[model samples]
Target: MDINMNEMIKDCLFFGMVISIFAYGFGKKLKDKWKLPIFNPLLIAILTVIAVLLALGIEYESYYASAKYLSYFLTPATVCLAIPLYQKLSLLKKNIKAILLGIFSGAMTSMGSVFLLSYLFQLSHEQYVTLLPKSITTAIAMGVSEEMGGIVTITVAVILVTGILGNMTAEITCKVFKITDPVAKGVAIGCASHSIGTTKAMEMGEVEGAMGSLAIVVAGLCTVVFISIFAQFM
Candidate 1:
């Protein structure tokens, strides 16, 4: 039975990878055809994968055992964002002050709002900390959550939802707020949504993509410091 079980797991290792790639590819096709924000490929891929797992009666752990390999690319992918920033190096230098200030304000607002809502709802320290890093990337958010004795899984979930919301509403929000500047738009999206929103920012324009990439790194650092100070108060 042990041998059989191991063999089964090994054989199914590629199953998760295949399913993920297929689902995302299908989602991309749908988005291309529909051209709608609601049809976000990542969102669709997530839902599709979940549904597939449920329908197939596959345990999430098993699926993740193989699917986690994709995550290995995350660090390199994030680093690659620097390319856009480098391309727009002159623009970054020209508006360094405004960019830094915007990211700082955004990071503060994210943590502050969570603090206020957690207090209003009477959430525990663990829960508050879990949510405090919701606006940052998964890598940094997970570390912060773990350091603060928060639930890492919950932090990841919150971050995903935050990113998806930002990805979906970025354009709408900008229009509603009359934010016409590409740099400001990039900063807002990256500060609020991290990489997922950065994807959308890239689609908007090169300048927006470059600024969004910079905001991700700066806002992440700011959140780390701000969260430490905020935790002392809690």
Candidate 2:
């Protein structure tokens, strides 16, 4: 007899909750105390969790089965980003042109540069399509990736990596380039990375977070629009 899928999912969820707390605590310590370059809380937690489960002879497949229900929240969780955009409506109106230009340019630069390089590498159609949405937010990127027959998991992985890197380098890069405006910083995070970058922006302060939130919406819309055009011509 096979194990019940529902019960399996519960186990995963329970473990995930525990792991997340561990990750947070780990990240917090890194942020507050000794600043070690090797302190990637998520990475450390993920590896530790996986190793513990594996050593205990727990099957990964069973864990995923139980957590499958939790995965249902992914799309909706991403869609909720619109709330922040609505909050910043007034600010957006004040500098609409500059914000729009900055966001669109950043998004185009993100996707275009990836496409070109992937093309140079002779990537397959599916691989190229995957990169197209890498600059957009995770939720929209997953939806777009699915629509274009690209691998959603691959898109998600790429986007996460981009977010981590973006968050890490944003401050340094912005200062070096003299990007003194909050709007520009926000757009840069959303376009160059997406949700992960927002986390970094959040640490910067309220203004930065608001801008990043708004940037996510604009960047997602811009990618959809421009990619559609690209598809029609190519």
User: What C-alpha lDDT values do all the predictions have?
Assistant: 0.84, 0.74
Query: Candidate 1 — which pairs collide?
Result: none
| Candidate 1 Cα deviation (angstroms), residue 108 | 0.7
lDDT of 2 by residue, 1-234 (tens): 777543554455566555546765876677567543235565455556567566655666655554455567887887787777788898789889988998888877877787778778988887888878887787888888898888987887787677778888989988999988877787677668777777778778777887888888888988887886554322
Query: Which numbered prediction scores highest in TM-score against the true structure?
Result: 1
Candidate 2 scores a C-alpha RMSD against the true structure in Å of 4.1
Score residue 201 of candidate 2 by CA lDDT: 83
For model 1, residues 69-155, the per-residue Cα lDDT tens digits are 887786687667567557666767888899989999999999998899999999988888888999998877877888999998788
RMSD (Cα, Å) for all candidates, in order, is 3.3, 4.1
What residue runs in model 1 are displaced by over 4 Å at the alpha carbon?
1-11, 79-87
